[model samples]
Target: MTLQTNDSAPHPNQFALLKQRRFAPFFWTQFSGAANDNLFKFSFTVMVTYQLSVSWLPPALAGLVIGALFILPFLLFSATSGQLTDKFPKTRMIRAVKNLEIAIMLVAAYGFFTTNLTVQIPVLLACVFLMGLHSTLFGPVKFAYLPQVLSDAELTGGNGMVEMGTFVAILLGNIVGGLLVTIPEVGHTAVAIGCVALALIGRWLAQAIPELAATDPQLKINWNPFTETWRNLQLAHGNLVVFRSLLGISWMWFFGAVFLSQFPSFAKEVLHGDEQVATLLLVLFSIGIGTGSLLCEVLSRRHVEIGLVPLGAIGMSVFAVDLYFASRGLPVVPVMGLGAFVAQSAHWRVMADLALLSLFAGLYSVPMYALIQLRSQPTHRARIIAANNILNALFMIGSSVIAGALLSSGFSIPQIFLFTGLANAVVAFYIFLLVPEYLLRFVAWLLSHCVYRFKVTGEQHIPISGPAILACNHVSFVDAVLLMAASPRPIVFLMDHRIFQVPVLGWLFRLAKAIPIAPRAEDPAAYDAAFAAAAKVLQDGDLLGIFPEGGITKDGTLQEFKGGIMKILERAPVPVIPMALTNLWGSYFSRIEQGGAMVRPFRRGMLNRVGLNVGTVVSAAEVQPALLRNRVEELLA
Candidate 1:
């Protein structure tokens, strides 16, 4: 179904989208499918380890074998599956994958019904591989389908809810799966019935999903998986920003796998708790992730705020380190149940650390998922997701190996946790260094929220893509940063050169790619360079923001427009958008009138209300300093 586009209307938030038909069915279908996969995987693993142990397969090898078997299909068939999704309507492909799940679940039911241990265990492993295959085929659709159904404004929250649902599903699946298969006489029957039921439910839900058009309908399908896989990986690595996001996301999976895989051991060795503690930790982490995921929408005000990613990384490291401290120097403690565990304050602190870890993990990861979807080329998006899946599998597998090596070398679980925490700091710094835009955008977002609450209107006037000149009223010292925060696309600001000489802000301005303009009389070279840089930015089809007033408003009134905007527009020939910033003149950054004498700008308020009103775009032929000023003043009014 082609939904009607109402550009003039404010976009509905993530929750509102959940109530709509287009998103609801698909969300439930995907959520159920994930839940079922984990349920079956966990149940089968339990049966293999306890009920059907064999001479050839040790209990320790069971988990490793299962892990490898599950990820193997993603490695082998993800490339092929990605092409299939791109060639067909994603909704239809998803339905087909759900149908495949039903058939596989029937086979699993038969395996469970059969009493032969040898046959049953192999069937279970085969089921794991098939589920992996099921997930691989669905991977690209899982991501690519969202952008089809959601608007850009909804992307971040949509991704957050999807990821949040997934973590919750995994939690329930593990808990329920473990319990279902331990029912003694009815264990096999229960597991069989549950799998078939979940498969049926997921397929029924998939039926209601609206059809989405294939991105590349005429593209030829590659017959060979190996060659196609290589090509798909290449497509994913094409852009530097996209590729670095890929690495960041893959590393998150590695970090998660490391911590999650250690839970059983951490609980047993450190807390002296049994099976219940493991489950408790799992539940706590899931809730934390869900909370953080939901909070992302609120924190970003429905934007994909990448600054949260860095904040999350910092929190993850700090909390992980705190967990080490909270749990260090442990004495012999009784195996406490959930209630007893909470009774001790020390254990509560540990739980707090673990919860914080999970919360930050959600913050760190959910944005990248949305970013990957929004950033990748449309035709190759599914392939890029495939590439991400490949990298995730590799990283997870690598983490397992590293953890095994560390533990085998006589390292405690605390030591491993500390190492992982420290490792995350190094990895985060490296990735942020590679993509400074994520960090810079983060800084702008932080500053905007901390000092002023922005009410932005006519933001749609700023083009989503291509070149444009944004001329705004300069009301305060932080006008550039506020405007940058309001824009979806990064805006290169042309600022007074003196601001570049101020202590730490100068470096930040340079890092933000701001053009430092000087008066022709004072420094002709800097003045010329500023105009040259502004021209280059527009020539390359990038947005450039300039405060046409030339300097900040002195007495809370709009200043006269300068001729520099006209010169910049003459060189670039892009649309000139006029914006107004109002209700900020008396704030900290604006000059103040003292009782007797004029005083400099001083800090005066917290969470002050300010508005950034973007006026309509003016054509270059009619672009004038007076005309732009009039438009800005009208908006400010």
Candidate 2:
């Protein structure tokens, strides 16, 4: 069954989603659940670390144990939850998950009410595991549900809002949990009441979510988690890009989990601050994530721009390294309150580093999540996300263990931050090398948005998925790069062989896997090979781009279309989208009056306006050289 998008409003603001029933109820429901989870967990961790004493559970290990328990269910039950999510209506699953959260919180409230440390600790620990189970069940449903309801255009913005909301919810939960647990007399009671109240609120919000049919209603159940987990990993591995993205996201969790799990001890020992300082760090990190999440929609111009991924990685590493330097040599001071910590000039850099690092983390993650949802098959999308959750859990658990070992080895918290930061650079570089598409897109995005102002009209003509031919007028050498920036999905361009000989741009085209075509009369083998490669791209259900005019025009005028597009259409009967590039004639990449392109740099200056106008799709039968040229000319006019 085909899943349709629920994007009724044209050019709607991301915030407007909060007002619609299709999105709002689900958003708030998940928000409340995140808040409750952190509220209960942080409150318990703070109580154990600062308020209570236990030999079996030391203060140093409190955060790690709590975090490990919460993610444990993701490793064990995520596969089953994902299968169930696919087989059943999402609204039903959401309500059921919310109900489970309510029950778990009630149990936790009872535990919090107990006065005995031994009884209270064990009961609360059990609740943490149960809460993890709740999140595991909801994980697939939360992510998979978005692609069902949002259009491709809205996917990035929608995911951004959710990322921002989740972190903000985390921020509030941590703040409240940290503060309430430190209260003089009613601290425990306050935390208990808050957890139950948030759970109730989440349940109430879940009731308002509209009914959504299951993506794969007939999928058979898989009872064994180990077998199902392996099967789900196989499903994700089927798409290398998606599978790598799953690993990338999991790695991010690994990096973040270390810092998050160390916050209590870092605040107490390193910064010499009270519990409020720990809460303040969370608040800064959460606000940064929220800001960065919102910035993604603005930065990408409301597109699923994966180009931002590399940029985000760079910032995350840079800020993380700076954080190490910022906090490395702080003066030894007495434990301070939030105000005193903020007032200290020496501590400001540390705070900035945390916020900025988390901000970039937000930018790095939202696009990947949107990409996974957009690329994965609709039928088993939940399972793929479940695989992601499983990987995330494993990586986070590894993070806890490694961090614990590092601490045991006498490495200070600042040194761990430095190690993680440097490690991030190596991991990100390796991933980019494995997938050059990311770097290529980054370069294209940089040129399109920075070197030139690019805009696209009738972008809907570009298919979000499946095979199609993009026939555009080749105006300048950078035309393909601009098109890449405009497209949500990758396009395989069949360009003249000479363009592949150009300086830096040649390397970029090669990296983008563009097919280099030659004239059939001059080099038959190369021409045949290029055509064959183009055919394979379309055969594999990917977009094929062609410059039917064969080469860049000498003058600022349209050239006669060549017959290459016709041959491609004959090989693969896909729709040909007519497009035109306007106002790129006098640009730096275009030919000058002397008939040489790229003779002068910045001829048109920065932010020069360039536009791509997409005409209606022409069926394979109706696609001809002259017809396509006429269509392009019409769009150009």
Evaluate model 2: give its TM-score: 0.95
Leading candidate by lDDT: 2
For candidate 1, lDDT tens digit of each residue in 151-267? Answer: 777888898889889899989889889999999799889989999999999999999999789998888999688898888878877888888998999998998899899998899
Candidate with maximal TM-score: 2
Q: Write the per-residue lDDT of candidate 2 for residues 1-637, one digit (tens) a residue.
A: 1112223357677898999898999999999999999889989998998888899999978876887788889999999999999999999999999999989988999999998887999999999999999999999999999988887778888999999999999888887888899899999999999999999999999999999999999999989999999999999999999999998899889988888877877898889999789878978888888988888888887878988889888998999899889988788988999999999999999999999999999888998999899889999999999999999999988897888799899899999999999999999999887788778788888988888888888877777767888999988999998889888889999999999899999988998889999888999999999888998988888888999999998888899998888788778888888999999998889987865877677767789988999877788889889988999999999
Name the weakest run of 10 consecutive residues (lDDT summed) in model 2: 1-10
Off by over 4 Å in 2: 1-9, 408-410
Worst 10 residues of 1 by lDDT: 594-603
Measured with C-alpha atoms, the lDDT of residue 168 in candidate 2 is 92
TM-score for every candidate vs. truth?
A: 0.95, 0.95
* Candidate 1 backbone collisions, by pair: none
